[model samples]
Target: MWVDLVVEEILREAPSHRHVVNDAKTPSGHIHVGALRGVLLHDCVTRGLRDAGADVEYIYGFDDYDPMDDLPVYLPRDYERYLGVPFCNVPAPEGGGESYARYYAQEFIDVFTRLGATPGVYWTSDLYRSGRFNEAIRIALDRAQEIREIDREIRGSRGLEGRYPLHVICQQCGRIGTTAVVAWDGREVEYECRPDLVRWAQGCGHRGRTAPFDGHAKLPYRVEWAAKWFVLGVTVEGAGKDHFTRGGTHDVASAFCTRIFGARVPHPIPYEFFLYGGKKMSSSRAVGAFARDLAEAMRPELLRFLMVRPHPRKQIDFDPAGDTIPRLYDEYDRAAEAAQGEAEDRDLARTFYFSRVAGDPPRGFRPRFSKVAFLIQMPTVDARRVLERDKGAPYTAEDERELEQRISDARRWLERFALPPARFTLQAELPEAARALTDAQRQFLRRLAEIVQAEAWEGEPLHTRIHELKEEMGLTPREAFGAIYLIVLGKDSGPQAGWFLATLDREFVMRRLREASAAPASAGE
Candidate 1:
């Protein structure tokens, strides 16, 4: 629904009906999962435009020509020598022929493609080398004074009087980060690579003059952003809120676009950050989960759901080490159910509709994720048989596929990210913690053993019986459930005890309960 609203705004305000929705990222290291937020945001807007019968193109650019200012900690310390060099000129970490930029860029590209977003990909290095930006570079050089004035007006910084807005690669050292264009003649620019230019990389003090075109030089970020819009004909683009703040990069770029380039500014969409553990993620700092790892850890549709369900203005805080994965699966399943029914909430239905990777949302028996997780850990239990029983019917092909995917997802979570309560291992012998149970807890377990032995019960009925016994014994829920979990899982909490026990061997459950109740109490108890 929010996507529809954004589409309406774009249609009303854009200079033209045919639109290009664009986003770009600099691949300095393993691209973090947070970058996917911008990719998917632009994607949703593109999809919405197409659905509304508007012609739209989605293009994603990799800023590969940008210099590597920060050496990622994951790389070798020797890589510090390459810090001032352009990413396109540095060697890949794995020593292949590919540039450092493309090596990491491809990893992130694969992730978004798996999420069903296939945008036309471009590289900044290619744009520069192929003369695509030659005219824009010339225009920027001729209007250097005007560009400086615009920056001063918007940002209140007036020290720049003769400095041009371009950086050339040093002719001697081949580093772009430390080179500054001091003066631009009609065709060539004088530049210097100063030793103390930046803290991250030391320059070689090289000086030269060259024509600042055809890949010889690059505009500063704010100018380059505007040039990309002019050359690419982008009509809609969104960035993080930091750039859209008062007197921020967006403000300066907008002025440069209109005054210097004589082009209409693209419609702006300012979005919030995607944080990990309450901190914004970084691509170069290795601050959050990498996009490739998250893609591998989750099903493609579920990952899409994680990005698409939240509004662009809302921040997402993800922590994989706790209940986050299980809860996300639960929310996705609910949306799927809602999408299939006409009477469900309309917003929920829209979320499910947009979250889909391809085709209609499958209609069939859907199982709860937690139960599937618990069932897979029980070595004696057939997860398929148990899920099929819960379905109360034979498995359809669609149901089987869905169950298999959930099984895979659950295993990944359990293996990598599950918290203690969500993880389970059936104790082969009476656990030591069970020996510390009070007399009342032992009495509750002894009665529960009799209930399990009396008859074979389904999950709901067995769950009901456990609650009744807890009430009858006058024990707190913790006492009643803790006793069961300690004997079976050697933990204080777990999946629904009734369904958990139903999946295990009847004899095993009966024996464990009996042993737990009869075990000698610890000396202190």
Candidate 2:
């Protein structure tokens, strides 16, 4: 909602050109799902800008020119030798089809595209190689001292402190981290490739400075942050909360923009990220959910909905290991229905509107997520037929497609993230857990077997019948359900027992219950 407020303010200011919003990330490893937050935030902002009558374009960049700072465990130990090389120049993993940068960058791009955030993708290496960044390099060198002062003033650094804003790839080893610009002669830079400059890679100790042009050298991150705005003329962008802190990269870059480059800095929309299992997601650490993981587990619109429903400032601690998927689907469904009706909360309804995959979302005959997930796992049950009966009508084409997609999503979620409580397999015979039931529980099962043979089966009515039998047989609801689970699911609990049993073949349900009701007799013999 605040994004709307920001876009409205920017609309009033009215940039002279198509409003440019940009986001960039270094493909240091497999891109984490947390990175999607920025992609979604910018999409929402760009849409808001367009709705507010501003011409807008969104560009996403992979900073492949950045040096590899850390290697993930999946890479070979020999990859350490390339640690300080530009990411685009490094080799991709064995069997990966492209350069290291393209491998991971393309994967992440596919993810963003599927999530409905269609951003113009630019690899920084391409910009440099194509000479697009040449002018920005010149600007950085000409304003080197001013840029250094802004950094020093903002970060409270003493002097230059052995830091130069420019890094030249070593002429001998082609490693960027081994060299630092020692002096500039107004044209060529003087530098040394020291062996001990960084821990990841050793330099050849060669000392020579060529013209830092045409992909030869790059500005350090903070300066480049400012350089890109001047080069691309970005008008609206958002950064995570990390960059908006006092004297952080955004502040320093804003200062550089005002004083050195004479360009309007990108408007700031500060947002937080999705945390994974209570910690920050880092691809290099391989500790958080990857974009690929989410792609496999969620439908595209549902994945987009996860990011859209939360306010930009709130932290989402997602545990993919839990029931967050089904719960999210339930919440998303409620929001979709509210959006369809005359509504009280317009912002929430607007969120549901934009959260769709594309075009109109499915309408009519939507099944509950939990129920769909439950029925898909049962081999003997035709879930579609059951769902149709439950709906009291056949599903429309769109509803059938939605049901199939939900089945795929539920299967993926079960395979990857289902906890013990969410899992159950139908028994081949009565389980030993059923043999331990008391005589009254066994009698309830025998009576339930008769009901299974006689009652017209459906979720609600059978559920009511179970309750009635619970009262008639003087059994607690838990006790009554426990017998069904132990006999059919081999546990003391499972999916809502009546609906679960209703989904199975009538003969199978009757036979399983009858076998369970007799388990104690065989045990005594």
Which lDDT values do the candidates have, in the order given? 0.88, 0.83
Work out the TM-score per prediction: 0.96, 0.92
Instruction: Count steric clashes of candidate 1.
Output: 0
Q: After superposition, which runs of candidate 2 have C-alpha atoms over 4 Å from their true positions? A: 13-17, 342-344, 446-456, 468-477, 505-515, 522-524
Across 288-338, the per-residue lDDT of candidate 1 in tens digits comes to 899999999999888889988988899898887777888998898888878
State how far residue 74 of model 2 sits from its true place (Å).
0.7
Superposed on all Cα atoms, model 1 deviates from the true structure by an RMSD in Å of 2.1
Q: Model 1 — TM-score against the truth?
A: 0.96
Candidate 2 C-alpha lDDT tens digits along 160-233: 44555788988888888778788777778888888887777777788987888888888888778888888988
Cα deviation of 454, candidate 2, in Å:
6.7
Instruction: Tell me the alpha-carbon RMSD of every candidate.
Output: 2.1, 2.5
Which regions of candidate 1 deviate over 4 angstroms?
519-525
Tell how far residue 173 is off in model 1, in angstroms: 0.9
